[model samples]
Target chain A: MATEIVLISLLKILVVVLTILTCVVFLVYIERRVSAFVQNRVGPNRTGPYGLLQTVADVVKLLMKEDIVPRNAYKAIHDLAPIISIGVALSTFAVIPIGDTIELFGRQIKLIIADVNVGILYILAITSLGVYGITLAGWSSNNKYSLLGGLRSSAQLISYELSMGLSIVGVLMVSGTLQLDKIVQHQTTYLFGWLPAWNMFLQPIGFITFVTAAFAETNRLPFDLPEAEPELVGGYHTEYTGLKFGLFFLAEYANMITASAVITTLFLGGWHLPYVEYVGLSSFILSLVYVGTFCVKVAAVMMFFIIIRWTLPRFRYDQLMNLGWKLMLPITIINVLLTGIVLLILH
Target chain B: MGSNGKIIRKKDLNFWQRMYIPEIAKGLRLTITQMFKPKVTYQYPDEKFVPPPSFRGRPVLVEEQGVERCVACGLCSRVCPALAIEVQASETELEKERYPIKFEINMVRCIFCGFCEEVCPEEAIVMSNEYELVFTSQEEAIFGKEKLLTPIEKLRPRLEWLKNNR
Candidate 1:
């Protein structure tokens, strides 16, 4: 069992890291494509056959590009910030179950790095650490724009984090377990033996709040006041260059992938296909199918992220805060209370 | 409000409108339809997009055994619509007339018109539809002789055709 656990853990880490990289590369491609389609333009069509190799070429270029550190900047922290951000981003994936375990080479392997009893909490805490990089990078740069962006991101993250945590608290309460795999298992059975087991139906309010919070956390559009280019210029990494700049971008997409994974795990019933029983399919085939199903769900959420980004205008920083604290928070709290009462009576 | 001076508005709620259920069902129905419908995207690697008949793409330089067919003629440079093409000439190993020694196209400047093809008597520089030109920097977009030549020109029969004809 220990050997199996060790192998599973290794596999999880490998999958998470690779997926993070692959998803970031494709997410950029997809975002460009979606944005192009929206604006009625043909996006990236060159690189490796249909421009699929564009990201790979970009990575090579970035790696080969000159590394320039500003003379006035705090060299140590400026260098360390991106590392911290990427570290935090990668760490959050440890708690997420992409899909359930299946027989592999005659051994069962779980799809999570660590199925900690407090997995949800662990993910939340780890993700929160990502802000440190932005703050440190901003402070180190000594640029006014970077400093202002860093401060805005900090305040924005802090405000939204509260409501985001609260929304998930209801989910944790309902599931009664922190282990993501177990939460998913609990959600596998239908609510009325007909309705599919997913939190989207049960906790609509929480789902909305959580999705909104994710948009805020990712520093994406509408909530993207931090990098409001017209106002704040290039945001926290305005002065960053070469691999350092690449790392910031890397962390952003990694966090995005993590957010999508978290959404899948929490609200979308990670890897659980509606109206389809996993009991009948062969274990190996079932795992593959589940992984495919999980990817489709993540892709939909990613597309939704892109679509909303294109559709919505950037919210004023104040408006963003008001929506988070005044509107979303109040509605979510009432939802939690009402949901709690209903669950209690049902129980 | 109905009896008092203040006016009260009556709201109508249909079964579907009363809840978000109808909207969600509609969304699901649309997604289902799209899933079954032919994917609009051209899967470029395995299944390339079938270019339209007049699709503008790769630059074709006619060759006799991998050597360019221009015979040092400067007509293409004169006829280039955007004035973006540059060709330098030098005597080939054949010890006959000079051919292009350095050939390049400034893709950033080139309007992608088939002007060069129309101007060429040698049937050189026809634009094929195999365009996948993605680059992060401006420098990468500039094409040299190596990149300007299509992969088809390197194939055995075409190379053979050029050599035998020459």
Candidate 2:
């Protein structure tokens, strides 16, 4: 039984890692294509059909390029930075439930890799650690631009993290659980037999705050001041080359995928589509459907991320700081307060 | 400038503008709409862009009936700002007094300025619509008479456009 459990855990880990990595690769492809469409240009359709293998080609190119390390750089930390970034990005996905339990060979298998009770806290903690990677990379690079980028990233993380944490407090109050699976289950019920009881409907402000903060956390455009190319010249990864640079790039897309998943799990009802249970499908089919629903939701969110990146210009440093502090923080705080009061009155 | 003739400081944004959500939404809507619009990018390489007659690409020697139209007057060589063009005149038996014994254009130095084409008294050099130029070595970038010559029929559109517009 112990052996079986161990095998299953290993299998889950392999599946999750493979899925997330594949998603990251394709997300890069999607980002380029979507940006092209927005700009009225054809981007990267030459590598393979519709540029499906462009990221694959890009990966090969990065791997083949010369790996250069500056003579004055801190070798150990500089090497370790991308690893830490990618590691944190991948590990955060372990707690996110893609689908509910499914029966296989007379044993129920849960889709999540690690079903930690403190799932939300684990995500928050792991995400916060991502900043360390950027900071370390900057400090170790021995380049002034890298140092500035790292500084800006760390400050941005700290400023936005407050509102991000507070924003989710409203969701937590409504769902009354920190486990991601529980949050999704909480959202399965319908209001007036039509609308799914998604947290998005209940806590719209929380949804907005969570999404904006997620964008900042992912270091995407508008909030991508750290890697603001016009100013910082590739930011913390300025000194990075070849595979090291590829790792940072991979970590970024992975963070984006993870953020999309987190948002889906928290506010958009994860694997539960509205009225899906009413279809009366078999257990196995239903589980497959759940996975599909979750993927579709995540894809939609990812498209939104891409669209917003191309649509909006990068925020000014002061505007970013001001928005994080003066606006998002207070709004999230109020949302938390409102949710708490309502929950208290109802109970 | 304001109607009062005083330089106006930028007007302060209202609460809605300060909030930025509405403006962001409008921008997003515009971009989403644009995503469905026709893309302006060419497939390139597979589908070569046929440039208009007015397009200035690389300077080529216009060859007519298996011979260059150049009288080898050396005007193009003199007018070239980058000194990209080099011409050597030699005695010819043809009606034209001289033909270039050696002509080379260093594409690396050629700025596609159309000066060589403009300064040619014989209309021997014209900017043909052949923009795809890749050289593996510095030595290879210097095009000899063979590489510089283009059939007059292939350059008809450019010649006609030059005739009408120049």
Q: Each predicted model: what fraction of the native A–B Cα contacts (within 8 Å) does it retain?
A: 0.00, 0.94
- The top-ranked prediction according to DockQ is 2
Candidate 2 residue-wise lDDT, B105-153, digit = tens:
9999999999988888888899999899999999999999999889999
**TM per prediction:** 0.69, 0.92
lDDT tens digits, residues A68-184, model 1? 887899999999999999999888988877777878778777766887988888988887888899988988998999999989989999988888898997787788877888989
Show model 2 residue runs off by greater than 4 Å. Answer: B1-10, B62-67, B84-109, B136-151
Please state the error at residue A177 of candidate 1 in Å. Answer: 1.7
Residue pairs clashing in model 1 are A46-B132, A46-B133, A46-B134, A47-B134, B60-B125
lDDT by residue for model 2 (A19-67), tens: 8888888989989988898889978887788889999999999999999
Candidate 1, Cα interface RMSD: 6.9
TM-score of 1: 0.69
Candidate 2 TM-score, C-alpha based = 0.92
